[model samples]
Target: MKIYLNDQLVDADEAKVSVFDHGLLYGDGIFEGIRLYNGCVFKLEEHLERLEYSAKAIMLTMPWTRQEISDAVCETCRANGLKDGYIRLVITRGVGSLGLSIKNCDKPQLIIIADTIQLYPKEFYENGLPIITVPTRRCNPAALPPTVKSLNYLNNILAKIEAQHLGYQEAIMLNDQGYVAECTGDNVFIIHKGVLITPSASAGALKGITRDTALEIADELGIPWREANVTRYDIWVADELFLTGTAAEIVPIVEVDARKIGDGKPGQITARFLEAFRRRVCVEGTML
Candidate 1:
């Protein structure tokens, strides 16, 4: 596979980062997971904007201009012959010393990888995936803001591991205050009383690009959608449950914890959103 490192596209095995790179040593970096469909990048500007937002959050400056980065992504996609695939763009505090000072690190790494990704099995999407609410609460935004898409994903990974051990495909993490924050890698939502509701950013949820797009789609379809702090009580009594992310897209949650959601099947509104979401991606955004 071809990887975009700096301004060049090279074999993945050959692309390298400095050992002292803070992104590797101290997780001092930000990233974005983007999608390309039919040779066109989905919400390319929004993803870049978020990447910049994350970089700024950490006081790191991107070495490449946004246009340069966008071009590199397209070039990587073309080189890899990707019709539909995932893009992982990363920027890190480059080559800093072991003592955690950013002074010596005069460079930042810009790496982009374009490839296919399927976070869950096809059957899971077909049958609706089950989610377990793990005990591993989300990292408090006060401790480390969830808005910054940093490399430190151990918290989310641990929850996912718990889900795997429990024989479920995905897991949800609650915030410190016992509100439903998000899944291991996706923001979650539920339909209640004909309204689509999701945890707000203050709830410790990642402000997911796909999550916002789903909200827009909901509005377009005349399905009421709103952002608010969501608790377990909301999840248990909701008419429908679903999760959204760049990679996960839109997936129905048939069961949360031990309770069945909407007759233990994908609810009508969940199905509707999924259908609308699936159709919107190919039609929306910048096409290559």
Candidate 2:
């Protein structure tokens, strides 16, 4: 395997970063998880745009332009001979002293890795997954916005731990105001009476790329979709439930908190969206 470190590609075992890097020391960094499909990158521009937006939100200056980042991603894929895989693009605060001040860092570091990823087992997707809600509320937007895909994921990790201990595959977290936020690593969606609904960005959910793609698919299929502030009760009584992310793509949730969703099976609309999503990614993406 090869990793893209700055402008050069190096063997995975040889790739390294400074131990004093603020990204590892203080979790001061942003990242994006992208998918490569059949020698093409799925929604590459959207992911790069989000990455830039996240960096700007944190006032972290990226050393490369979006076009350069895109070229590096494709270069990394070629270096590793990766035709179908996952891409992790990271920009860190670089090496810094033991301090919280951003000025302590010299320059931001860039790391891009192309590798295969399967976030869930085949059975999970085939039979659908059952999940539970956790007590770990999402971080308040004023404190640390959920929209930024930063390296500090302890908040979501804590909720994920609770779910794992309870023998569940995933966990759902609510915002400080008790509105549904999202899952540990995916965006939540529920269908009701032929309508697809998901939490808006203002509701503390990360603006997911796959989530937006799913909405586009819904529109193409003539399925009504909307964004709103949803509650636990809405999920409990939902006609169908699903999750979307760069890695997860679209996965049906058969049950939530012991309540079966839509006959304890993946609903017709969920299946339709999943199928359409798969078809779209195959042809509608940037070739490597």
| Residues 61-174, model 1: lDDT tens digits | 887888888888889999999989999998888887897889889789889999999998887777888788898999999999998899889999999999899998898899
* lDDT per residue as tens, model 2, 134-214: 999999888998899999999999999999999997999999999999999999999999999999888889999999999
The numbered model that scores best in lDDT is 2
Worst 10 residues of 2 by lDDT: 279-288
Each prediction's whole-model lDDT (CA): 0.89, 0.93
Which structure among the candidates has the greatest TM-score? 2
The residue pairs that clash in candidate 1, if any, are none
List where candidate 1 sits over 4 angstroms from the true fold.
Answer: none
Q: Assess candidate 1 and give its TM-score to the true structure.
A: 0.97
TM-score to true structure, per model:
0.97, 0.98
